[model samples]
Target: MNFKVVPFKALTPQQLYTIYHLRVTVFVVEQTCAYQEVDDLDLTAEHLLGVDTDGRLMAYARLMQEPNQQARIGRVLVNPADRGHGYGQLLVQTAIEQIQQLWPETTQIKIQAQHYLDQFYQSFGFKPVSSVYLEDDIPHQDMILTL
Candidate 1:
């Protein structure tokens, strides 16, 4: 998979549409979670898009960093059609690298990950900071990866 990190303003209209489409498909419909899919967060976050050779979006996440605050990784998802091919790991690894490069002052990265992915995030050295809790009715755990 090919990876690219783009700021919100740099994303083309079509790419933005595709990103939202996949997020809705996976996070809303596939996961059966109902809540706001598009929020103000998109306006300032750096978006990581992992695409196949054909330019098809395969994975995505939003990266955000603010002064004196830990960077955040959110809205992470692998295209349902493109799962099981390690794109999830690729997408996440790329997101982490991007954060480290773009915000060297950041001391950590935070994620509100689905409960099922707790171990997966742990594999990346993300320690659970909160016990399992419901977010939008889906079990989630807050995790932090210290840089």
Candidate 2:
């Protein structure tokens, strides 16, 4: 699969549509969660898109620089048809690399990961930093990857 990562403003309209559709497909329609997916974060955060050779959005994530001087990664979503293809890992690693480049002095990366995927995030050096909490009716925990 061909893959590339770009910032939010750099995303083409087609890519934006595909990313939104994929997020709604898995986050709301499939998971039955109804929270607003298009939050204000996208305006300033770095967006990463993982597309296939056929130009399908396989996975996506966002990186944000917080006021507390920490780099954050969130909104991780993998297309249902693309799960188990290691696309999630690739998406996240790409975001982390981009964040590192964007903020070289940043030493920690934070994420509010779904509870069930704790081990998956751990594989990327993210450790549980908070007790599991409910967000948008789903269990989530704050995890951090310290660089």
Candidate 3:
């Protein structure tokens, strides 16, 4: 898979459409959660897309720089048909490297991850920083990775 890290303004129309479509398909439809998927945050995010050889988006996430200079990774997802292929790990590892390149001053990365995936993110050095809480009816916890 090829990874591309682009600012919101730099994404092409088709890329932007595909990102939202995939997010809704998995986060909303597949997960059966009914909540707003496209929030105002996307306007300021740097999107990371992992595209396959066929030019289809198989994995994605958004990187955001917080006011305190910490980086946040959010909206992580792998295509339903493409799960169990290790694309998700590659997508996030690429995002971490890209965020460091984009913001060398950043010393910490944060994520609001689903409770069940705590171990997965933990493998990337993220430690739980908050108790599990319900967000949009799904349990999630805040995690941080100090660089």
Candidate 4:
């Protein structure tokens, strides 16, 4: 499971491709979500990618800080075969570190997480801040991790 988590700007073309392919495989094909994955945020985001020993992308997510004083963590995805490997948890921890590095004064990390995974994110210190709502036809809730 040799992996490296690099910022979005530091990602190579191949790395970006591996990420999108994995996202499409899991989010689109597996979850049946037909929405667009590339929402124009990647250009300014700091991506945390988990590449396996063979250079395959096992997991990925992005981090961005908006004007509302909220640092966002989104676009979380893990390859189907890679589930239960703890890569997603590592990706999140790395993303949080990136946010802290970029905005040390920031107090909260926000995420619109899928409803069923609320407890999973909670284990990492995230607290639900919004009533559950549907996003892309899937139930989701807004969660925030306060630093």
What is the alpha-carbon lDDT for the whole of candidate 3? 0.94
Candidate 3 error regions (>4 Å): none
Tell me the TM-score of model 2: 0.91
- For each candidate, the alpha-carbon lDDT, in order, equals 0.92, 0.84, 0.94, 0.83
Name the candidate, 3 or 4, with the larger lDDT value. Answer: 3
Q: What is residue 106's positional error in candidate 2, in angstroms?
A: 1.3
Scored by lDDT, the top model is 3
Per-candidate alpha-carbon RMSD to the true structure? 0.9, 1.5, 0.8, 1.7
The TM-scores of all predictions, comma-separated, are 0.97, 0.91, 0.97, 0.90
lDDT of 3 by residue, 72-117 (tens): 9999999998999888888889989999999999999999999999
Model 1 lDDT tens row, 1-147: 888999999999999999999999998899898999999999999999998888999999999996675899999999989889888888888999999898988898999999999989999999999989999899999999998
Global lDDT of model 2: 0.84
Who is ahead in lDDT, 1 or 2? 1
Note the residue pairs that clash in candidate 2.
none
Task: Encode model 2's per-residue lDDT on 9-112: one tens digit a residue.
Answer: 89889888888888788888988998998889888877777777777777788789986668999788888887887878888878888888888888899999
Ranking by lDDT: 3, 1, 2, 4
C-alpha RMSD between model 3 and the true structure: 0.8
